[model samples]
Target: MKLERKHALVLLAIAAWNVLTYLRFIKALVDTEDRPTGYYVAHTILIVVNLLIAALLGTWGVRAYKASKASQNAQV
Candidate 1:
């Protein structure tokens, strides 16, 4: 589906939220070094995956926003 400017904005907002929330989670995880190696390993994997997702969403949002702007400019 083609994304409008509003949809692109929402995706960017979500991506931003994910990064901010996960950064805090990482800090908390770091403080809790008492956890077992397995626990840390699992959480680390989750963090990595979430960050990757955020990156992907952010990229999509930027591309969509740019495309929409370009189309509008061309039409004007």
Candidate 2:
């Protein structure tokens, strides 16, 4: 399916939000005390997975947006 400008924007927004929010979460996680080893391990894995997802989304969004603009320019 073709990704419209709006879809690209949404994906970019989600990617940005995930990066910003998860960075803050990492700081909080570091500052917290007395967490079990398993807790930190699980959360670290979660953060890694989410960050990977964000990277993928950001890449897709950027490529789609650039393609849309290029197509528009070509039509002119």
Candidate 3:
């Protein structure tokens, strides 16, 4: 299914937002040095959670966009 310009733009914006928001967690995980094992573990968990959320959001957005496009095509 084809996404219109506006739909594509919105998807792009959401993806960008997801990446930007999660980047801090990733940076923390990467940049921290001489930390305790528990500290690393906590950051790892946070990063995993962030990735899961982003994946879920991306999947939902793609499915919704495709469904809308399919419905529009059917009506035409």
Quick one: how many clashes does candidate 3 have?
0
User: How many residue pairs clash (N, CA or C atoms closer than 3 angstroms) in each of the candidate models, in the order given?
Assistant: 0, 0, 0
Candidate 2 clashing pairs, residues 3+ apart or interchain: none
Off by over 4 Å in 1: none
lDDT tens digits by residue: candidate 2, 1-76: 8787888899999999999999998999999899899999999998999999999999999998998888789889
Per-model TM against the reference: 0.95, 0.95, 0.69
lDDT tens string, model 1, 22-72? 999999999895778999999999999999999999999999999889888
Q: What is the lDDT of residue 19 in candidate 1?
A: 100
Question: What is the alpha-carbon lDDT of model 3 when measured against the actual structure?
Answer: 0.73
lDDT of 2 at 9: 95
Q: Candidate 2, overall lDDT?
A: 0.93
Q: Which parts of model 3 have CA positions greater than 4 angstroms off? A: 1-16
Q: Order candidates by lDDT, high to low.
A: 1, 2, 3
Quote model 1's TM-score. 0.95
